[model samples]
Every structure is written in C-alpha cells, then in structure tokens.
Target: MLVIELRLMQIIGLGTALMMPIIGNLSDQYGRKALLTLPMTLSIIPLAILACNRTTNYFYAYFAFKTLTDMVCQGSINCLALAYLADNISYRQRASAFGILAGVTSAAYVCGTLAARFLSTGLAFQVATFVSLFAVVYMRIFLEESIPADQGEGITQPILKEGEEDNIIQNDDNAPTKVPPFKKIPSLGYYLKARFHFNKNQFADLMLIGGIVATISQLFIMPLLVSPIGDGRLLSIGLFASCVYAILYSIAWSAWVPYAAAAVSTVMVFAPPSLRSIASRQAGPREQGKAQGCISGILSLANVMAPLIFSPLTSLFLSEGAPFHFPGFSIICIAITLMIAFIQSLMIGRAPSTSNAENSTEV
Candidate 1:
C-alpha cells in the first residue's frame, strides 16, 4: 500500500511539473478566472467517476483520472491564483498574504484529513468536489479579469503588427475581437523561444539555476527524512515513537505540527519576497516576474522529481519490516543537501555585481 501510494504520488508530481507552465501560459492568454474555472469544473467529473470504479483495473483508471485532474486543476489553478494575487497585491503585502494563505491552506488540509478519517473516502471526495464546483461558480460570478483587454493587446503590440491586428479584428463592432490565437493560447515552446531570443537577461539564468538547486536539494532531503523511519530497527523505533508522538501530538502538543509547519512556511514565504525586496531596493523591478518564474519553475521541477527519485532509493536501501531509520543514509543526504543550498546562496550573493547593476539601471 505504501509503495503504491508513493508511486501514485510520484506520478502526480511529475504530471504537475509538466502541466503547470502550460496552464499558467493558458491563463496568461485566456483570462485566469475562466481558465481556472474550466479545470475546476472538469476535475469533478473524474472524481465522480472514481467514486464508482470498484475493480483493480478500475483502480488504475482511477489513479490515472485523479492524476490527470490534479495536474490540470491543482497545478494550473495554483499558478494562476498566485499570479493573480501578485497582480493585485503590493510587494510589501504579498509576503504577508502568502503567509496567511499558506496557513489557511494548511488548516484546510488538516481539516480535510480529519474529515476524511471520520467519513468514507468516497463521501469525503464527493464533498470536496461539491465544494470545488461551488468555488468555480463563485469565481465566475464574482471575480473580475485581472488582465484588461486593452493591456493584453498593448503587451503584445511589439510582437504583433498593426496589419495583423486589422486582420484579427473583423468589421462587426460587437464581434469578439479576434486576438491572435497565440495571445490567447501562449505555447510553452514559443514563450521560451521569445524569452530567450529577445530577452538576453542574465537574471533569468540566475533564477533558473537557483530554482534547480533548491529543487534538487528538496528531492534529496525528503527521501532521507522519510525512508529512514520506514526501515527495520528504525521502523520499530519509529512505530513506537510515532504512537507516543501521536498521543502527545493529540494532547497538548497538537499545536506543534502546525507551529513547526508555520516556521518552515514562514521561511519559504519570506525568502523570495525578501530576495525580491532587496533586489528591487538595490536593483529595481526589471524582469522580476521572469526571474521569479524561472526560480518557481525550478522548484516545481524539484517537487516533481523528489518522490520519483527517493522512493526507489528508499526501497532499494532499506530492508522490509526494518525500523524506519536504519542506516541513517537518507538523513546524511539531507544534511549534505542543506549544506549545498547554503553554499550556493553564498555563491549567488558573491557573484559579480553586473546583474544587480543592470537591474538598478533598468529600474
């Protein structure tokens, strides 16, 4: 069951990485609200279908359907939502909003898990689906398009010609102006090509590298931390400890998980914002989104790879029925990854001032 769960999660992670950028770009082209709604609405169908499948073959189908739904709805919606938030919130307030948002999400997760424990999985899932459908309806009714029609055209003006606009816009006054399909469905390939070809910015590279390193580190850390607890002697220790911890956690220490999670989230929430704030102060807001995107993309990639890479390693190295933390190999890897991340951050700081100077000049 554990192995199956791990594999399923890994597949979902990989699918998410592939889909997020596609959805994000789609949101940029269409409106975030509409694109987001489409996925949310579509996601329910799969969950509903899964609720009916009873056989082993049906289980595989369920996994595939659930994974697909998650890839489309979860990945895209999150990317669009974050971008949407960034669009409205001032830099000063963004971090606080993100922190609050993270807390809310964590709370929601805990509540959902508790609810699932009490309720049947099918009923819990169905309830979630209903809530999501309601959310989509709410968004459609209330949410305004963040990208103005005029601004959308203006942003693409350099790449799209006056003649092209005329052809795209027909004679009917009320006819929906035929925006270049590319403007509506931005392709990942095209966006990357344009970004790399036209924008020869070094900051993009920095963001990409930083993001990749961070992701790799996370991938290394998770397996090491989790797998050890699942091994022979380590497994026994972990099982006993977990029971004790669970009891304690249920009691006065119920807050500990949330507190610890908060601490970790606080760091993540602050890190990029702080970096951006310093960059904006010293260098300015030139190419901020692109740089951030590169970093985010790298992190997403890391999230996708972590489970895939770690699970197999854990299975291979750790003995069945062993305590969760036998050899301590995974922990060592995590420690090393942390050290590497620290070293990389220092190196990034010390790198030549050219990028900073350019950012300041652009600002």
Candidate 2:
C-alpha cells in the first residue's frame, strides 16, 4: 500500500513540476484572473465524481481523474493568488497580506474538517463539491484582473539577471536554498499509523488543533511580527519550528505528544508567506506571476524528490525486516534535514523592501 502511494505521488510530483512553471508564466502574460479559472474549474470534476459514488470502479475512476486534475490544480491557485496580491499590495505590506490570506485558508481547513467529522463520507464529498462550485462562481462574478489580457506580450520574464533578484537570492550565497520538505508528503501519516497507532478520527482532531493555532497565529501574531523582525528572521524561526515539529513527531512517546506538536505547527506556518513575500519583491511589477511561478516550480521539483528519499527509508524502518528497530528513523532524518536548512536560513539577511526603494526613488 505504501509503495503504491509512493509511486502515485512520484508521478503526480513530476507532472506538477512540469505544469506549475507553465501556469505561472502564463499568469504573467494572460493576467492572474484568467489563469485562476483553469485550476478552479477543473478541481470540481473530481470532487463531483466522488460525491456521486464510491464503488471500486468509481474509486478508480476518481483516482485517475483526481491525479490528472491535481497535476494542473495543486500549486497553481496559490501561486497565482500570490502574484495577484503582489500586483496590488506594496512590498512592505505584503508579508501581512500573505499571512492574512493564509489565515483565511487555515480557517477554511478547520471548518471543513469540523464539518466532515460528523457528516457521512458521501455527504462530505457532496458538500465539498457544492462549495467548490460556489467558489468558482464567486470568483468569476467578483474577481477583477490584476493584469490586463493585452499586457501578456513577451514570453520571457527574467528571474536570474536583475539586480533585485540578486538581492533576493544572494543572502543564501553560502548555502543555496534547497526546498524544505513539509506535510505535502504522505509518509508522515504512515509514520504515525506505524508507530503510535493514530486512526482517522485522531488524525482529524490533530489537524483541527493545528489548523486553529495556525489560523490565530497567521491572522493576529504574524502581522505584528513581520514588521519588527522582517521576513528573513520570521522564515528562520519557522524553519527551526519545523525541525522541532518533526523531531517531536519522530520521538512521540505518548499520543498526547502529537497534540503538543500541533501547537508547534503554528510557528512553522510563518515560513511560506515570508518566503512568498521575499520572492514577490524580487520581480518587476509585471513579473510577479513569473516570480511566484518559479517559486512553486522549485517546490514542485523538491516534492518530486521527497517521496523517493523518504518512502523507501520509511518502509525499511517500519517493517519487521528492518536493519534496525527504529520505527521513527525516517522522521528523524526529516528533522535533521530541516535543521540544516534552518541553519542556512539564518545566514539569509532580509531582502530590502521594494516599496521603500520605490519611495526613495520618488523623493
């Protein structure tokens, strides 16, 4: 089962890696609102399929459609949204903007999980399908284009050569930033099941607690922190917390420990918006979509590598035929890897605010 999951993810990741850059770069040309329609509309098909039936034939049909749709839908929505925000918000204010956006998404996660806990499986899928349809409708009726369709003239959007791009990326001069792995991988749930014996109910509860904390932290705490310490330090703190979160999960002595780790997950939430803020400032005004797309593409490529590294390690450690008795070994390696990235992140000085630079130019 685990091997099957790993193979599925490997295929999904490769496809997503290829697709994200194309989606993002297109957003740069066609406008964020135009690109948004593709992912949102396609996402509903798979959900609607599952909402109708769940026999073995239906299940396989859903799986096939789900994989194909996710290849285009997975990272594209958030990537384009970030680019849209970049178009409207000043660089100095963007970290908070991104944080607020994340908070809203977290709130939705909490609500969906809470709703699903009581609903039957089929009903939950039905509700999800309706919600997805509503979201698409709302977007089409209410959302305005951040970039005009006519502005998508050139194919090339430069990322590597600009002076600002150098400032954005050069802080990791000694340590090139490899994509830090996260909850996107399937191994974490398998590790919990294999080790401490967590069930679906327990998983939902854990996620709810984590989602609540993350929503509060991103909505209230992050806005305040982003101004004082800046994106660099906040990212560093999130990375450290990420390491700790994995470490706690790795050595979880009791079931309660995972709950404690849930609280720690809030700090880890700070990293993505901070990274997005940093990445957004690197682009020229028209290039926001291209910059964010590049970031998503980089992450997709890392995700491609993640399961390959962890899945086999996980199988060996969790199985009775293991070379050693450490069931949590794969997670420990995950933590160690994060710790290395966190240390390297410390060397990253904050990219100077593009808005402030613009203001100075005006004066």
Quote the positional error of residue 218 for candidate 2 in Å: 0.8
Poorest 10 consecutive residues by lDDT, candidate 2 = 172-181
TM-scores of all models? 0.56, 0.86
Candidate of highest lDDT:
2
lDDT tens digits, residue span 100-137, model 1:
33334434544554556578877877887777778878
Tens-digit per-residue lDDT, 1-363, candidate 2: 756776777787788888888888888788899999999999999989889999898889999999999889888898888888877766668789988888877888888888788899999999999999999999999999888333332221112322555453433211101111244333788888778889998888877887888889889888888766677778888999988988888788887888887777778888888888767655566777877888887887787787778878887998999998888889889989989999877765533334333432210
| Predictions in order: lDDT | 0.41, 0.76
The reply for model 1, stretches above 4 Å from the true place, is 1-10, 51-60, 148-297, 320-326, 346-363
